[model samples]
Target: MTTFHDLRSRRRDLLDDLGELEDAFAEVTAALDEPSNDDEDARAEQRRHRAWLERQRAGLLVVLSETERALLEFGADGWDDP
Candidate 1:
């Protein structure tokens, strides 16, 4: 019941979401790098946040890979069927 348009749209949306996540990760990394905020407690909090962001980024990457594989298989199956 899925069309090529649907697959493409889904892929685009996922890619956009991935981009946003990467941007956020970069911002968090930059904030962590600032030497002025040298408070130990603050640095610990930032490290925790960075870890969470890394986990989220990793999860998204896995999902994106799976989606790409699905799209490829869908195309191949469409061509091979009937």
Candidate 2:
């Protein structure tokens, strides 16, 4: 029995999560750009981490899109008490 309130809450949470992930992604990209004395193994680990973050970001974006669509479909008049 999901309500409009629930959808809105989920959307807000997703947006926050996306923002944090974006910041982390930027930091990782900057780290990758800079010259470091890290060993091959360490660099590889960083690349892997970046890739994982990218995948997570993509998934979150998809969920966020879906949530937005649901909100639109529900409309403002569809508010149901949680």
Clashing pairs in 1: none
lDDT for each residue of candidate 2 in 17-67, tens digit (9 for 90 to 100)? 999999998998899999999998998988999999999999999999888
The C-alpha TM-scores of every prediction are 0.77, 0.88
- How far in Å is the alpha carbon of 5 misplaced in model 2? 0.6
lDDT by residue for model 1 (1-82), tens: 8666566677777788888888888998999877764779888888898898889889888877876677787666553222
Cα RMSDs of all predictions?
5.0, 3.5
Model 1 spans with C-alpha error above 4 angstroms: 1-3, 76-82
- Residue 12, candidate 2: how far off, in angstroms? 0.6
